[model samples]
Target: MSEPGGVSTGGAIGLVAGLLALIGGPAAFGKAGAWLADRADRRRQSRADGNREWEAKLKAWEAELDERAAASLRQCEEQCAELRAVVEKMRFAMVLILPEVERFAPSSPLLQKASSLLAEILPVAIKPAPAPPERPESISA
Candidate 1:
C-alpha cells in the first residue's frame, strides 16, 4: 500500500534496482573509471613534456639575442672611437690655421670666431689602448 505522500516500499526497491543496472553495478563501472583515470594521467604527462620543450626553445632564443646585442655594442663603440680620432685631427688643423690668420690679418673677424669656437667646445681626448708588455727573450742555456 502507498503512503499518503511518499513512495511505496515496493516502488522504492524497484527504482534502486533499475539505477544499479543502468550504472552497470561495480565491475563494469570500475573498468570505465580506471580507463578515464589513465587517459587523464597521459594528458597531464603530455602537457608537462610540451611545457619543457617550449621553455627550452625560449631559453635558446634569449641566449642568441643576448649574443647579438653584445656584438652590436662592440661595433658601435669602434665606430665612435674612429669618429673621435677624426675630430681630434680636425681640431689640430684649426689650431695651426689660427696663427697664420692672426699674422696676416690683425683685425680679422675669422680669427676671432675660430678662437671662440675652439674655446667654447670642451675637448675630450681619447686615450689609446695600452700595449701588451713585451716578453723578455728567454735565454736558452
Candidate 2:
C-alpha cells in the first residue's frame, strides 16, 4: 500500500542527514580558527625579532656619531690653539715694528712714507687696542 499523503520514508531520512551536517559544521570552523591563531603568533614573534635587531643597530649608530663628534671637537680645538699662537706672534712683531716706525717718523712726510711701507709689507689685518689697567680708578686715587 502507498503512504498516506504520498510523502515517503526516504524524504524523512534526507532531512535527518541535513540536520546532522548543520550541527557538525562548527567543528570545521574551529579548525580554521586554530590555524589563524598559530599564524598570528608566528607574526608576533617575527615582529619582536625585527624590533630587537633595529634597537641594536640604533645603539651602534649613536656610538659612532658620538665618536665622530669627539674627534671633530679635538680637531677644532687644535686648530684654535694654532690660530691663537699665530695671532700672538703677529702681535709681538707689530709691537716691535710700531716703535721703530714712530721713532723714524717724527714729521708728516716720514710718517706717510712709513705708513705706506707698512701697508705694502705687513698687510696688517686687525689692530688690537691696548688693554686698560686692571684697576684704573684705584690707581688714580
Give the number of the best model, judged by lDDT: 1
Q: What is the number of residue pairs that collide in model 1?
A: 0
C-alpha local distance difference test of each model: 0.77, 0.72
Q: Residues 56-105, candidate 1, lDDT per residue (tens digit)?
A: 99999999999999999999999999999999899887766666666656
Worst ten in a row by lDDT for model 2: 125-134
Clash pairs for candidate 1: none
Model 2 C-alpha lDDT per residue in residues 8-120, reported as the tens digit of each score: 67876666556656777667457656877989999999999999999999999999999999999999999999999997798667656665556544455765565666566
Residue ranges of candidate 2 with Cα displaced over 4 Å:
1-31, 107-141
Give the CA lDDT, 0 to 100, for residue 39 in model 2.
96
